[model samples]
Target: MMNCIEAHGLTKQFAGRLALNNVDLTVGSGRIVGIMGPNGAGKTTLLKAILGLTPFGGELKVLGRDPWVSRDALMNDVSFVADVAVLPRWMRVSQAIDYMNGVHPKFERAMAEGFLSKTTIGREQKVSQLSKGMVAQLHLALAMAIDAKLLVLDEPTLGLDIAYRTQFFESLLHDYYDKARTVIVSTHDIDELQHVLTDAVFMDGGRVVFSCDMTDFDAHFHEVAVKPSDHELARTLNPLHERHSFDRSVFLYRNADVEKLATLGEIRTPRLSEVYLATISNQTLAQKGSPK
Candidate 1:
């Protein structure tokens, strides 16, 4: 598969403090990748770098062009949606469509109108009159109508209610996704977002701590529900993480003997949320033990 985005030794610093540190990442075509991390972990910085919104050091390319040097041309093949949609307050729904049609050569006005037809938003409704959810709908309709090769979303559903959030994702998967388009989404909603991801990357301290394709994740990680008598035995295998639930305990392991784990207790594939927590926990431990 051809790579849509590639970076090696990518470094970015803000006021002498590192935001992205020697990062190496590659995103191939037709992928739905999720970027997760705690605050200040460089998730946003990485996304910005991909979108050519921030200056950084080292080799970085999006669609085979240096992002920093060719950002204006890059914008033609890229579309972005931030947590907050900032449309012109005085522009009506119809005008927004017209504005996008005039600026983006790839935007399909009929397609945008078709998407809006499913929503309650009226053509005469001004941006200021629409609710937050409506604004998100408008933003999504506009963005999805474009024939961009890469779509970047940063906290696309930050403040919406559960209904809106669920609807937003459903619309994205059912309407916008295809084998020709690549998507990169940055959000903290791991549990809700995991299902849509073809790959996931967990970052900490401005670096990638863990990354895996969803299909291969199971082979590399496992979890076992251990009986009280087997807890000690399970610990002997050096489980990556362990958690208790009143009378039962689950131990997360990486590259352990499946047969041995099965003998210890019930073995199953771990959830993305579980693996992500374990990755972050282990990263913290490693940092604490590193030399000053």
Candidate 2:
């Protein structure tokens, strides 16, 4: 499969601070990847670089073209829903469709209208008149109507109710997703997206600390809930992270002996949120211990 995005030694600096530091990443076609990180962790910077919205150092390519130099050409095959408010608040639903149809050659006006037809939003309603959830639905409708190879969504459903958020993802899966296209979403709602994501990229302190396919997650990481009596035995395994949960100690291990850990306590697959928290915690501890 061809890679939709490729980066090697990709670096971006803002003023005197590093926003993206020597990052290397590859996103292949036909996969839904979730980019997770805290604020100022380079998630937005990386997306900007990919979308050619910002200039950056090092090699980077989107759809086999340099994002900086070939942005216009690259955009022909890429669509993005940067945020819920990207669309002009003054634009009416009909005008939004007309504008997209006129601007984006690949945009299908009928398809966008088709999506809107299923919603409560009316063609005469202005974006400013719609609720936050309705705005997200409008944006998603426009994005999904584009015949693009790669789609990038950054907090696409921010400030929406759970029902709307669930509808947004469901629409993506049922109406837009296909084997030939790729989707990359960056959001704080990890648990909500856990089932939707085929792979995950965890970033911290302007760098990617971990990236893995969801299937390989269990092979690389393990989580065990152990009793106080087994804490010593669990400690001998050198867990990446540990924390107290009610009466048990939850230990996170990386490439550890699962069979041995089974003897410690209940061993089960860790949720994406659990793995992400443990990974960030470990990174924080390592940074603190490093010489300044």
Candidate 3:
């Protein structure tokens, strides 16, 4: 598979603070990859670099072109949607559609209109008159109608209710995703978004701590809820993370003996959130010179 975005020795500084610290990342084509991290982890900065919206020191490429140097040409095959409230509050829905038609060469007026028709939003309604959910819907429709190969979303569903956030990703999965297109999303709704991701990347302190394909997650990571009697035995095997749930002790392990874990208690696959927590925890431990 070809990579849609590539970065090597990517560094970005803001006010003498490193936003991206010698980052290296690769996003393969046709993959729905999630960028998971705490705030200040350089998730937004990385996305901006890929979109050519920020200047940085590094070798970075998006869609086979240097994004910062050739942003105009790169944007022809790229589309972006950020958090809600970006639209002009005074603009009417129809005017917004017209503006997109005039500005983006790949935008399809009919496609955007078709998506809006499914909602209660009226063409004459101003953005301020619409609810936050409606604004997100409009933004998503506009971006989806564009015939772009790479789509970058930076917290696109932030601040919305669960219903609207769920709907946003559903539309992307069903209405816009295809094998020929690639999407990179940075979101806080990890558990909700994990199901749609083909790949996952975890970042911390402006560096990528862990990355893995969802298909290989089960092979690389494992979780077991050990019985009270087996907690010490499980610890002897060196679990990456351990937490208590009533009487059962759930342990997360990496490249562990699955068959041996099965003898401990209930062996189960780890969720993305679990794996992410373990990744960050391990990084902290390693930095502290403690055993992971």
Candidate 4:
């Protein structure tokens, strides 16, 4: 598979305090990879490092080119939208589109028009007057227009109501991520994107603690509902995560011991989000790392 992004020992620091430790990452072309972590887990730092937005330590590459040195070349093939609003609030919707076209080589005017038309954002409205959600959608409009090979969205759906979030992601998959572009989204809501994801990477304390592919999800991890009596045996193996309600328990575990677990009651396949949370929280407990 062609790799659209690569990183080796990528590290970031502010005032000598480590924000991102030495980390390695690889993102393949034509895949949508979801990145999740609690606040300050280094999700945004990693994305900015990949985009060459913040100066940092270690090697980072996007589109097979070093982002630190070849940012202009990298930007030609990649696009990004940080959580904060970027466009000048004073600019009108039409002005933002015109400026993007002037700045990016791959900007498509017609693409931006069609995207904005699907929503209520008028070409005439000043960005300053637009609601938070409208600004996000406007940002999405420009991103989809860029014709980039890879897109990185940092909590793009944040501040939007449920309906807009649904419409936005639906438009992203159907219109932008069809067959050509790769996307990596950093979000807190893992379950929201679980269905459409091709792969997942979970970050804890700036390190990737879990990574899995969608096609292998159910086959690799499972949840079991068992009697409270089995909790002791289950604890020995260090289950991913477990919960108790009343006298019963639900345990999430890797699929490695599926056969042995047959004796446990009512085994069921887990959703990606469930498995992800279980793994990270359990790993944290074992490491004595407090969740942020």
lDDT of 3 by residue, 97-170 (tens): 99989988999999999999988999999999999999999989999999999999999999999999999999
Flag clash pairs in model 2: none
Give the alpha carbon lDDT tens digit for every residue of 185-292 in model 1: 998889888778999999998998888897677787899888888889999998999989788799999889898998987789888889889889889988899997
Point out the worst 10-residue segment of candidate 2 by lDDT.
Answer: 212-221
lDDT tens readout by residue for model 2, 1-292: 6699999999999989999999999999998999999989999999999999999999998889889888888888899997787789999999999988998999999899999999999999999999999999999999999999999999898888899999999999999999899999999999899889989999998899988898677787888989999899899999978989899999988889888988988788788898899889889989999998
Candidate 3 at 265: error in angstroms?
Answer: 1.1
The lDDT for every candidate, in the order shown, is 0.90, 0.91, 0.91, 0.83
Residue 192 lDDT in candidate 2: 95
Stretches off by above 4 angstroms in model 3 are 288-292
Query: Tens-digit lDDT track for model 4 on 1-292?
Result: 6688888788888777677888788888888999988778888889888887888777777887878787888899888876647768899998988888899999999999999998889999998888888888888889999989999999888777888778878888988886578999998768879887888988877777788887678887878888888888776655678877788888888755887676777778887778877767776787786555
Name the top lDDT candidate.
2
Better of 2 and 4 by lDDT: 2
Question: Judged by TM-score, which candidate is best?
Answer: 2
Candidate ranking under lDDT, highest first, comes to: 2, 3, 1, 4
TM-score of each: 0.95, 0.97, 0.95, 0.93
For candidate 2, the TM-score is: 0.97
Clashing pairs in 4: none
TM-score for model 4?
0.93
